[model samples]
Target chain A: MTNLMRGTELARDIVLRASEKAAGYTERTGRKPCLATVIVGDDPASVTYVRMKQNRSHKAGLESRHVALPEETTTGELVAKIRELSDDPEVHGILLQHPVPRHIDERAAFEAIAPHKDVDGVTMHSFAGMSFGHSEFVSCTPGGIIRLLDAYDVEITGKHAVVIGRSPILGKPAAMLLLARDATVTICHSKTAGLPEIVRTADIVVAAVGKPKFVQGDWIKPGAVVVDAGYNEGNVGDVDFDAVTDALITPVPGGVGPTTIAVLLEQTVDAAWRELDA
Target chain B: MTNLMRGTELARDIVLRASEKAAGYTERTGRKPCLATVIVGDDPASVTYVRMKQNRSHKAGLESRHVALPEETTTGELVAKIRELSDDPEVHGILLQHPVPRHIDERAAFEAIAPHKDVDGVTMHSFAGMSFGHSEFVSCTPGGIIRLLDAYDVEITGKHAVVIGRSPILGKPAAMLLLARDATVTICHSKTAGLPEIVRTADIVVAAVGKPKFVQGDWIKPGAVVVDAGYNEGNVGDVDFDAVTDALITPVPGGVGPTTIAVLLEQTVDAAWRELDA
Candidate 1:
């Protein structure tokens, strides 16, 4: 009997709950829960992602505002635009789509969003708050992963969990959340030696590296829970699913990707709740 | 045949060099490197530490401006005092002695000091900057440990380094710095299972668990360079010195402790340089 952690279904459930909450808030206060999407350049992948996010937000009964910039946009220009959105009361959640043009400093652009409206949790301030276990906006993918693990009744405390990647949004924040859960967390990246050997020791392995099938099936310990956060080319993931039959693993395309937008919408409703109280 | 890393001697050398640089800067710019020490109470240890730092600053030809507050001072009052120091042009480094009265929120106190003047590196901003591999004021002890390692020509890149502890000041930042150096870093805290077995795989071990002699010598891999960043009661460290014969370990009292002050002084001078340039 295979116990699959279905992300698309879970995401649908989450989006519906968020929509209900958002509708309740709108009824109480005449304003829809608003999310601002800041996109730079005409990158196809970025455009697709932002459009998907906006579609999801609209379906969740949240207002979606789009700010598109040209490819030649400067970091200062992007930062100014984000700051304007941050100051606007209508924008409850701000999503600065990643991989801004190479010339524009991405970190600087992300920092432009005010901490309160940083619903995507891409800012350093949000990162620090999350690491300190404070109640703040969390990185979307990691936050969604944590929700998935919780929904599955995965016992994280005292578990030997290993996170295979160190990206600011996904891997690092995931490790911090796991650490806060009383799990013994270890982060492995490009510099890591003996990758397969370390994977065999994990009670929970989070394969977040973008490389396809980096973690082999034989490397997974028996009964170990696996979270493949990678969305690589051709629907491949960081972990090789064919090799592992004894463990519970999230599917590549339908697992982490669907939850990203769900978490974003959930956070939008949360932001609205906080703003109403304020 | 002592191959041990002596932190005290190294720290003294660093302090001496900082003193010379401080003197030179004063001669060139007609102003001494000044560190403003803000203390909220007369906690004996705090007072002692402040006095020790002042003495060292004086010896290093740097000026120390002490801002002493009453024991009953509120968080707002303490923050205002810290802000005053932070804004003072005469002060290059702002050091808020920790463990401010029980009534005061110490984190707020740390936040009051601007990141540029945060030589002690206690603020979340400074922590994030250092963790992300930015050139910022690092936590004194961890900064000292890295300096000690580099001075000894210990190659960190592509090496297996295990850090024991998860404290903001040491363990987490140390792991980040090691990762920046291209070393595979693992942070094992109290919840870590079979820590000894994990440590055995490390080529470099940083014991910062705070418990005296918590890491056994048998757990240390042979010829691994050990940095004992812990200082507990009776001048004891996290590692059992008697248990390890093959590993090069840093002793308790003479190890990470002395280097803390050295790093503090160096960072003060660095802040002075930056402020003058600005």
Candidate 2:
């Protein structure tokens, strides 16, 4: 029987832990943990993502502060706004909705978020910390994938994990995290040759290329665990759901999405605790 | 006819360019490019390494400032000394000799070096920059490996490059650089299973496990280029030199050593230029 990797169930457990911690933190400190969500322009997808995060924050007993900037905001203006949030003592975490205006320098804006409060783990400092295995804030998608794997008691050490995609926030960080767990990790992209043959050799496969059904079932090894991090149009995923007879796999709609929000809330609470101590 | 990748010749070209650049900088600024070499104790190998770096600096028309801390120096003291060098306007680059006293926090010491002046690329900032495909200073060994590959005109794009080992300064950084160049990179370590089978698939193989003759030549694909970055005891390398027929390979003593120092000198000069501009 192939086990469905139910991200919703796993995410519930994590959210429960974070919620309890946040309650106690609020009770003791007389203030709730705060996450500031910043968005530039009104990209429909970005707007929905921010709303989902804010809703989840409320469910987790955390405070959500929303900032909406105009479409004409320049990179300098966006960075200045992020810096203001970074300096705000009440804000414990910051999440900048990605794909800001085409003219805005997204990297510069992300870098403006202070490293300690980078709950989304989009900055260079966060990437460096993850690469060095120091356990600082990890990009939410990759962190969720790890939590899903650990919940299933999957043994990562000595396994061969092939990751398809190299986006800084998703694919690249996922490979590094797998490597840190002692898994032999191979990162492939659109430029990679012999893609199917490479996927067949993996003990674990992570499909994050953002192309719906890009990875066929036949490419996966029997009994291999697969995590599909791609959420494309119509709620489709990179891996063809019907193609592979896998020992474990995450479903497209519910698999990775909920877990991402769970990790964000958990890290937000963690940031709050760290800040309180400081 | 198999081609031997000669580091000395490539390094000579690089050093000559750096020397000319350094001479011009000195004439313009009335001061030479300076590299500060810091050692924690009198380990013979460490001492010899520092002296070699100093000798190379002079040969390249750069000045070397050596700081030998006592064996009993604490991590705090070491960090303080490095910070002093970081703040010194004359010191354009800083090199912290590795394997400090067992109790000393080497990571902390490396972090103490200012990011712009981290010529050796041992700090976390340099590693992230390499991973993100932004050209900052790279760790010397990986920088040298890239230079050697470039010198030989090895085609890396879309190639399968397997790197053995994951040491922070060498293996990890080397894999990141290869990935940045568009190669599908697999990182293997002691925990990796079926290592030989994995190696046989590589179009390019980098042996950096520090175990002498650990990677047999039979594991190498025919016509594949091999780079042995390991300089094991007794002038041996991780790859068994006599065991495989390959298109190109780097010898143990001269393959990667000279190019590493060359990159150090070159980066020191580059750092001086950046600092002067700032």
Candidate 3:
């Protein structure tokens, strides 16, 4: 039987738990778990994303502090702003929206956010922790993917997991997480030759190539669990959902999106609890 | 004819160049490039390794600072000592011999070495950098492997590289480096199932599993490149060198050993130049 792993329903349960935890922490510590979102150069897409995140933060009983800088802001300026939030005890989580103008050094800005406040898990410390199996927080999409796999009772140990991307935040971290769970992980990028043949050998596949419907059903092995981590234009995902004859997979629109945000909020509250307890 | 990739000959050239640079820098600035070797317990193998590194450092016209701590030294104390070396301007490189008594936390100690002086490349900073393509220094054996492949004109782009280990310093970093160079990298550990079948598909194979001749010759594809990065008892490597019929491979004794130490000395000199320039 072809099973659709519904991420939206799982996300509802996760967010609800985070909300409850946030409320209890706020009542005890006299402070709401706070998330600080930083953005530069108001691209419409980025602005919309930030607003959606802020709304979710509020609904989860957490405070959202948004910092918007001008388009011409230097990498130095951006890093300074992030550092301030990282040092602020009030901020439990720090998130800097992606594509912050090509002029700015994004890596430097990500590094500036202190590890404790790095709920988004974009910093090097978080990356090392993830690779070394001592992660405090994982990047939201990867975390959500792991949650989805576990929720569906998928066994990771001794399985072959093919991760079809190498982006630092998404594909690379996903591979590391799967490897930590005892899955023999293979990371494929655009430069990889015979990618389809490689993907066909996976017991579990993570398609994070960002191209719409990039993975066809024929590329996957029989009864493999496919995780489509790409959200492209026209409400499409990396996997062609209509083409799959039989397999457990995530759909484009309601799959991975809700869970991604849910994991972010959960980790934010988790950071708050950890910090407050300290 | 299958050519043997000789690491010893290549390493001699590398060390000679670094020695020349060290002499010029010492002549101009009146200070030798310095490496600090830290050891917690008197493990015989580790002591021999440290002494060899110090000897190589002196031969390369650099200073070797040895710090011997008691077996009862705590992780906190070890970190404090490494932190002192990290802060010292004279120490251009820091190497902490691994297996620091079963009680001490090794990860915390590795994290203590600052990225600039992390010639050993065992820290999280080094791992993240190697993974993300901004690497300052690589872990010695992996760095040597890359150098050997390049020197021997082994094409990496679009090739399948199967790394048969997952240690932080060797297999993990080696996989990251190969990925950075556009190879399709698969990381297989002890838990990996059907290991021989996976090894048979690789264009390039890195044997770092630390077992003596664990990889059988029949496991290799024809005309593949095998990097034997193991130093087991009786000078045996991970790959069974005598059994391989038609593959470019490294031998047990003279393969990765010389190049590993040579790379450390070269990087120490390189670090001195980078810091001095800064």
Candidate 4:
């Protein structure tokens, strides 16, 4: 029987720990940990994501400051807003909702957030830190995937991990994190030929291609641990969930999604503690 | 017949181009391009390395500013000196000789060099840029290796490139550079199990483990392009020079070493043009 890697359960445990930490931090510092969520020209999806993060922050006993900009906001305007929040003493962490505006330079805006308060881990500094294996904050989804793997007692060392896709935040960071853990990591992308053949040799498979059911179940090696980081429309994932019989696999709705928010909250509390201690 | 991938020839070509560029910039701006070299403590090897760089800079028609700090310089003192060079308008590029005193924090020192003046590409910003495929200056050795591969017309796209070792400067950056070129990259380090089996499967193999002759020639796949980035004591490489009958291989003494200095000089010239133009 293939075990379901229940991300919700693991996320719940992480959230509980973060909540306790948040409570203690508030008690000692006389102020709740604050995460400022900045969103520009809010697409419905981005709005929903920001709302979800705010809700989770509240549940973890952290405060949230929402900054919704106009649809026509320029990159400079957005960067200035982010810089303001980055300087604000009340803001312990900053989360810039991605896909801010089509014309806005998102990378520039991400870099505007100070490294200390980059709880979302979107900056180049954060990415380098992750690549070098000493990041204070990891991009949320990748961090969530690592936590999920750990909760399931997966031994990453000496294992061959094949990561699909090479997005800046998700795919690239995930590969680096796995490599830091001593896994022999192979990164395969769209240009990779004989993709399924390569996937068949992986002891651990991570699907972050953003395509719905892109990886067929048979492509996965039997008894391998599979992680689906893609949450497509209509509750589907990049991995064809029903097709593979794996030793462990994360489901679409309840798996990586919940854990991502959990990590965000945890990192927010972590940022607060570091800031206060310093 | 195994073709010797001569770094001397390729490096010579690059140096010639950079020389012409430097001469043109000097003519146009009324000043030669300048590279500031900072060294802490007089490790004989490091002194030799710094002198070699200075000689190469002079030959390339660039000016070199040599700063030799005391052996007892603290990390803060080192950072202060670097920051001064960073702010100097005449200094187009900066190279901090690596392996400073054991007590010094190397990463902190590397971070001190301004990103724009980081011609040696040792900064975290440079590493991130290399990983993201748009670096102004790549770490010298990895950039040299990529140039060597290109000179031989080795196809990187979709090829399996296995990189051994995970040092912050060499192995890790090499893997990132290869990945950026669309190769399927696997990073195998000291803890990697079944190392030979993994090496045997690569279309491109980079031996960087720092162990002399660690990868036997028999471990090489037939017709694979082999790059030995290791230059051990007595001029030996990580790969057994005579053991592998590969399509192309870089020898230790004249292979990676010449190209590294070539890249450093080239980037210094590039930095001069960018700074002067601005």
Question: lDDT by residue for model 2 over B1-278, one digit each (tens)?
Answer: 36799999999999999999999999999999999999988998889889999999998999999999999999999999999999998899999998899999888999999999999999988988899888789999999999999999999999999999898899999999999999999999999999999999999999989999999978998899999999877989999988877659998889998999999999999999987788
lDDT of 1 at B18: 92
What fraction of correct interface contacts does each candidate retain?
A: 0.66, 0.87, 0.89, 0.76
Better of 1 and 3 by TM-score: 3
Per-residue lDDT, model 3, residue B113, is 99
Best by DockQ: 3
Docking quality level of the chain pair in candidate 4: high
**Pairs with backbone N, CA or C atoms under 3 Å apart (clashes), candidate 3:** none
**C-alpha lDDT (0 to 100) for residue B111 of candidate 1:** 87
Error of 2 at A94 (Å): 0.6
Q: Write one digit per residue (lDDT tens) for candidate 4, span A115-209.
A: 99999888889988998888569999999999999999999999999999998889999998999899999999998888998899899999999
Candidate 4, residue B132: Cα displacement in angstroms equals 1.4
Q: Which lDDT values do the candidates have, in the order given? A: 0.87, 0.93, 0.93, 0.92
Q: iRMS for all predictions?
A: 1.5, 0.6, 0.5, 0.8
For model 2, the superposed segments whose C-alpha errors exceed 4 Å read none
Task: Put down candidate 3 lDDT per residue, A163-198, tens digits, no spaces.
Answer: 999999999999999999999999999999999999
**Candidate 1 residue-wise lDDT at A163:** 93
Which stretch of 10 consecutive residues in model 1 chain A shows the poorest summed lDDT? A1-10
Alpha-carbon runs more than 4 Å astray in model 3: none
Colliding residue pairs in candidate 4: none
Clashes of 3: 0
Ranking by DockQ: 3, 2, 4, 1
RMSD of each: 1.8, 1.0, 1.0, 1.3
What TM-score does candidate 2 reach?
A: 0.99
TM-score of every candidate relative to the true structure: 0.96, 0.99, 0.99, 0.97
